[model samples]
Target chain A: MDYVLTTNALCKNYRHFKALNGFSMHVPKGAIYGFVGKNGAGKTTLIRLICGLQEPTAGDYTLYGINNTDKKIKDSRRRIGAVVETPSIYLNMTAEENLKEQYRILGLPSFADIPELLKLVGLEDTGRKKAKNFSLGMRQRLGIAIALCGDPDFLVLDEPINGLDPQGIIEVRELILKLNRQKQITVLISSHILDELSRLATHYGFIDKGRLVKEISARDLENACRKCIRLEVSDMKVFTRVMDSLRLEYHVLSDTQADIFTKETITRLVLSLAKEGCEVLSLTERDESLESYYVSLIGGTEHE
Target chain B: MNKLLSANFTRLKKDVFLKLCIIFMFAIGALLPVLDYHVMITYEFPRYIDESFFSYTSFMVILFSAFCSLFIGTEYSDGTIRNKLIVGHKRMDIYLSNLTACIIAGVIMCIAYLIPYLLTGIPLLGFFIVDNISTIWIFLGCNLVLLIALAAIFTLVSMLNQNKALSAVICILGLFVLLMLGAMIEDGLNQPEYFEDYAYMDPETKELVIEPSTANPYYIRGTQRQIYEFLSDFLPGSQIIRLSAMDAPSPEILAMYSGIIAVATTSLGIFFFGKEDIK
Candidate 1:
């Protein structure tokens, strides 16, 4: 598999606090990798480490095959564009002016692409309006626009939609998808909004307490959260016997509750259970959601 | 680096505070000469015209502080410094670029004041009023060096801090404190070495009576005087006051001190800034 970014036991500490502990993740090329972690779960810390804003305390990471400690890692970073936490921008500068500053910083050949960049991020009409006056969504888009200035192949956005309204969230999502598909840019977006992330992420890395609990593909997550039927039966022993005889795959949740994964007609299932002297009190058709899957992986109370 | 410098200058052109500061410098330049002309006409006082030309240096210290602090402070508050690093520009390059731009701003402001002062002063109060013809030239050179030093100090203060308002306060307050210290030291250095005692004939006899002579405690003597004098030349504030007075100021020594300050502060600023963690 071709990966644009990968980490091996990446660790970072702030004095006595461990921000990132043995965090290892992989972002495949052209994949919208969602980094799922609660607040203070080292999502921003990992972003900072990779973006070269802060150095790792121990372990290391590779960007496009260059190790973090190598002097040439700076060259590797040339391929990355990041909007960490809040967008890094000059509030005094207008949208176009901000991008021009970024262009100058990148030593681009000309300002020829500034307009196109603004257009790409849907800020083409924000003429002479300073970034300070821009709405939260517009500022976020401008931040994304600035990041896209150097045409980086990999974009790392930390909490890209933290404070955006629903519309703003949708716009950012579509922009990310467009960038990944049309521009062929690999995106590593860390967001805690699991449902929203489910719509876009091709892969996921679930982190808890600075450790990656699981790394799963979207298809695999869907398969893991496949459709199942939850049943509350009168007798557990009879329910198991009936399910065994029927050869239906299921998981026992409690003495009286069980989830059946195999598909069968509702009439047929009730009839089969009745023959085994099992009375179904309640039955529910259920499909596990991403939130439950994440909870299951991390295995704890809500941290959000 | 050239790109960084160019971009900084481009930004500086649009900086409102710097524009206001330049205008302020010019206003002072035009006003100070007229004030000197008034003092000369009203009291026939010996108005030092050459000294009046460089009166801008005294105010440039605080003006430079405000300009340098707020200008660099924006980078921290806005988080634009990370952008430069993200684009692969060296930290040293960014720091030096900012320092250079501020120095240029200081120069422009100084000239903005100098031009108006000379334009008004020479016609009203006459030129070359001082005995030494080269004092004005040396004073101008010293003022430039002092500006460099002041720029260095303010740059260090501003770059070390991430809060814009706090940085400005520190820079401004730092200039004021240095000014007070410089004035105190100059006052100490100006003390007399000895007290003179006079003798007069007594009314009872045809004889002279000698009064008691005492040592001047305020007089800075020996190594202490040397230290105070060296300090007067070393401190930017002291240099400002000294240059304003034009008290046989040595252009070479002032330039050397300013060079030391510029190099020292810039090196330290770059080192700390390179190690700083950008949010």
Candidate 2:
């Protein structure tokens, strides 16, 4: 498969703190790759390095098959647009003025596209409003517009929806989806909001403690996170033995609760457990969520 | 000031402080000369530091340096350096953009100091100078030294610190250090002490040559009739052009002073500052 980004044994260290340790991932072409990690898991650091803001302490990363140290890497970067953490907009400049500045930064031929780009980000009517006075959501949209100045096909957004209200979040989400689908731009987004991430991700890369825990496509992830029977019983040991006798795959969630990963014969199974003198207090079936899948994959506590 | 400079120039245009600083320097620079004219009409003279480029330029340079450092250094401590790189600008371009602003700020301040000095100090010359051309050269020489020294020292301070308050304090201290160090270098080198002259010391292998008298190397032969002191050799801090203007500095010595302080320090600043990582 064609990949937009590939990192091998990438590492970065700040004094005694190891921000990214041997991190590696393959971001496929034309995919909305969701970079899921807890805060301070080196998400921003990796973005910074890939963006050329810093040099990696060890290993390397490649963009569009061009190695970072190669002459073509600079050319490759021109095809990328990124909003790392916060918006990079010049606060004192107006939105149009900011876009003009970005055009110069990218060495573009003209500022003629400023109107269309601003309209795309919903800022076309914001005549002469300096970015400093912009609302957070407006500023964020302007930031996205700034990133889109060079018409780059690859976009990197770090926590783009963070610190926004629900309506603002939806606005950003719809914009990103439209860009990916209509404009055909590949995107790499990092956010702690799993549900929001799941809504837009075509593929997933789970990171923890400076290492990539897993990388799964959306369809495969949906299949892996299945609808299972959640049973609250009096004795988990007896329930476990019964489940083992049934030859079913299950996991004990707590002292009195467990999950049975099967869709068939639920009534029959409960009767069987009752016959075996196991008291089933409450039995319910539900679909697994992205949060639960992430927890189970990394073996965190029962309550997220 | 053309489009080729547009790359770095846009960065400055967005920054209000830099813009305001330029206006501030111009207003003050334009006024100092006029103010000095008023002082001169009463037959009064300012102190060497106030009147000399070293004192006046040093003061303004320290101020300009603080402004530049805060404007540039805040980005580093705040992690905004990453955003600039992500926008596709190389480290070198970012460095150059900032350094241009610093040098430009220095030039503005230099212009500020010169206007008033020429408008006022020129008339009070009272026959000390033989011609207008010589007086202009003297002003040019002093102005070059002032801009060069201040730009170098301020660039160094900006690179070292990121906090606005701390950087300002450090820049202020840097000026003091520059003056003190220049004094130390002058004092230690000009004292003509001989190693073999001490009775307790053994003979020396190197030739033991001594000058006859103790005055600055610049003070060659002095007479009461002269308007200012005459020197045999150039002293680094000694004024190349005095207000009295009776004795004009030779072209060779003027070039040497301008080259040593202005050219040397400015280039060194550009070299180091060009390579500095904004973060």
Candidate 3:
């Protein structure tokens, strides 16, 4: 795969605490790479290192094949636009004014793209509204607009959908999808919102304790997630005894609920439960979602 | 660097706080001479335009303190500094561009005061009455350099600190402390070496009694006096006071001190700012 970003054992230390410890990952070109980690899991730290907001204590990363230590790395960075932690924008300026300031910073020849950029972020109709007065969603969109100013092919966003209403979340989600699909801009999104991430990410990197637990494509992850039949029974002991006697692959989720990973006939299982005097309250086939996959992969508190 | 500077200047044009400072300086500039002219008429004494000419130095110091802190602090508070960094601008360039913008603002504030002061004062009072034309030139040169030094100091404070409110408080409070220190040093330096001996009629004895002169304990002399003199020229607050009174013993030395301060603070600021981690 052609990679736009690749890291080799990157590390960041804040005084005595290590935020990122020998963490590494690869983001393929034109792929929406979901950076998944619980809070304090070094997701933001990695983004900061890549965005040049903070320097790593050890190792290095390459942007567009340019090593970070190389003098020409800055030129490679010019192809990236990032909103690390929060949207970096001038709140006192209007949305249009903010873009113009960014344009000036990027040294674009003119302000011609300002309107098109605003419209792309759904902020064009906000004629004279200063960013300070913008809603959380509007501000976030404006931040994305600012990130999109120089027509960068790679975009990095840290918790882009955080603290938004449902409508706002949907808007931002649609916007991200549009950017990825239509513009083909490679996006590296660091978020703990797995369900939202699942909808957009083509590939994912699950992180825990400042290290990458796994990096898998969405297709591989989908195939890896087991299809199980969730069963709620009256007598948990009887159900376990029968499952043990049958030697079925199973996981106990609760006292009365269990997941059987094997493909068993419903009639036989029901008859066996009936003969054991255990009532089957419900049984349903379910696919393990990204949330459950993350939980199983990291195996800590849910969402940490 | 040029792109960052152009962007910074664009933001500088819309900064309301800076505009307010400029207007306030101009108003104070125009009013100072008018008030001194009133004093001249009411008290029946001559007051030269030169007396109030450099009076804007103190106000300029305060305004620059407030302006630089807010101006640079806004970048950190609003997170806009990251925009520049992520767009491939070097941290050194960002620091230098901010310093340049602040220095320009300071110079503009000086001009704002000068335009009104010159327009109002010269017609009412008169041209500079100093012994030589060079003194005025010297004062102007020293004051301009002093402004740059002050801008550098405040920019250093604001750039190193990420908190806008805290930086503003520190810069403003820091200005007052320096001003007070300068005033105290100047006061100590101004003390007479000895009290003059005097003869006075004793009310009880009705006889003239002569008293011997005594040395002033507050008088700063020797190496201590030299240190005080250097500080009075070195500190921006002291430079303002000295320039205002037109009593700079050596304007060349004052300008040199200002140059040193500008270079030192800027070097220190850029070094630390380069190491700072932006969120």
Candidate 4:
């Protein structure tokens, strides 16, 4: 797989506390990789280490094939833009002024792309409004705009939708989607809001207790948490017989309940059960959500 | 580094606090001479225009420190420093760029005070009253060195602190403490070696009374005096106090000390800042 970012046994220790312990993951190129973890589960720690905000205690990572220990890693970082934990921006400057300042920091040649980047982030009209006076969402968008100063190909956002109103969250969500889809910019978004993350992420890295528990593509995750038909029948033996004859995949929950993995026609199911002397009591179509799949995979609730 | 310096300069141009501080210094510059002019006209007292103008060095230290603190503190408060690091600029470059910007700011502030004072004082009072033109130039040079050293010290304090308000307080308080120490040392160094004796008619005794002379307490007589004199020359604060009198005989040594202070503080500041896990 073509990965824009890859980590190998990356570790970060803060005195006695290990923030990231042997954590590893991959963010494929052009993929909006969702970094899923509970609070303090090393999601932000990994982001910080990667963004050069903090150093890792041991091991290393590569960005655009440049190793972290290499001096040229700084050059590699030119391809990355990150808003870690909070939006790193100058609050005293207006949105336009802030972008211009970031351009200056990045040593960009001109201010020509300022308006376009602002427009892309839906902040083109925030003229003359200093970032301190901006709403939380506006500030978040402005932070993203600052990160996009040099037109970086890879973006890393630490809790991008955090503390946003519903409207704000939707706006940010749409913006991330647009950036991924239209611009083909790869993104590494660390967020605990799995439901929202599920909507945007083409890949996921589930982290727990400073380690990566799993790394799964959206397609595989969907398959593992796919839709199923739940059935309640009069007899388990007859239902098993009917399922076996029909060659359908299922999980038996109780003596009388079974969940069929395939999408079978209701009439055909009933007929097949009837011929096997199985009386159908009730059936309900259900799909395993990302949240439930995560809970089941990690053997705990999201709150954990 | 050039880009960072230019960016800082851009910010400095728009900084309202800096602008206000410069304006305040200019006001003091213009007003002090005007007040001296009033004193000269009304009381017919002899006054030196150059002295009145150069006296601003004392207050300019505090003003310069306060401005540098606010200017550098804003980076931490606004998380703008992270922006530079994120863009691949070295930490050393950021620290030095800020130091350079603050140095430039300090110079501008001094000029703001100097220009008005020179324009008003040279015409109102006289051209030079220190006897020698070189003495006046040496004093100006001493003030410049002291300003750079002060800028470096304030930058170290301000950048090391993550809290803006706390850094501001530390920068101002630090300058005030140094100023007080400098004044104390300068006062001690000015003490006379001997005390005078007096004989007078006692009011109560109705006879002549004699009081014996004792050594001046503030006067130094040993190696402690050497240490004090070295400190007076070495410290930027003491240098400012001494230069205010326009009698810095070895202004070159003071400039060297200032250079050392600037280099030492800047090196330490950059090292510490490089280790800082910028949030």
TM-score per candidate, chains pooled = 0.88, 0.73, 0.90, 0.91
Order of all candidates by DockQ, from best down to worst? Answer: 3, 4, 1, 2
Segments of candidate 1 deviating more than 4 angstroms:
A229-263, A266-286, A302-304, B129-135, B195-214
lDDT of 4 by residue, A1-304 (tens): 7888899999888889988999888889999999988898899889878888778889899999999899999998888888987888788889999888888888888999888999988998988888889999999999999998888999999999999999999999999999989989999999999889999999999988899999999998887687988889999998887888889998898998988998789999999889878899999888888887777667665445
Cα error of candidate 3 at position B179, Å: 0.8
Candidate 1 lDDT for residue B130: 63
Least accurate 10 contiguous residues by lDDT in model 1 chain B: B243-252
lDDT of 3 by residue, B187-239 (tens): 98899999999999999999999999999888888999999988888887788
User: Comparing 1 and 2 by lDDT, which wins?
Assistant: 1
List pairs with backbone clashes in candidate 3.
Answer: none
Comparison by lDDT, 1 against 3, better one? 3
lDDT of 1 at B257: 90
Model 4's alpha-carbon lDDT is 0.87
Give me the runs in candidate 2 sitting further than 4 Å from their true place.
A228-286, A302-304, B1-4, B43-56, B74-83, B112-135, B138-142, B145-149, B156-169, B179-279
Clashes of 2: 8
Candidate 3 on A74-146: residue-level lDDT in tens?
9988999998887888999999999999999999999998989999889989998899999999999999999
RMSD of 1: 4.5
Residue pairs of candidate 4 with colliding backbone atoms: none
Query: How much does candidate 2 score in TM-score?
Result: 0.73
Which residue window of length 10 is worst by lDDT in model 4 chain A?
A295-304
What TM-score would you give candidate 4 relative to the actual structure? 0.91
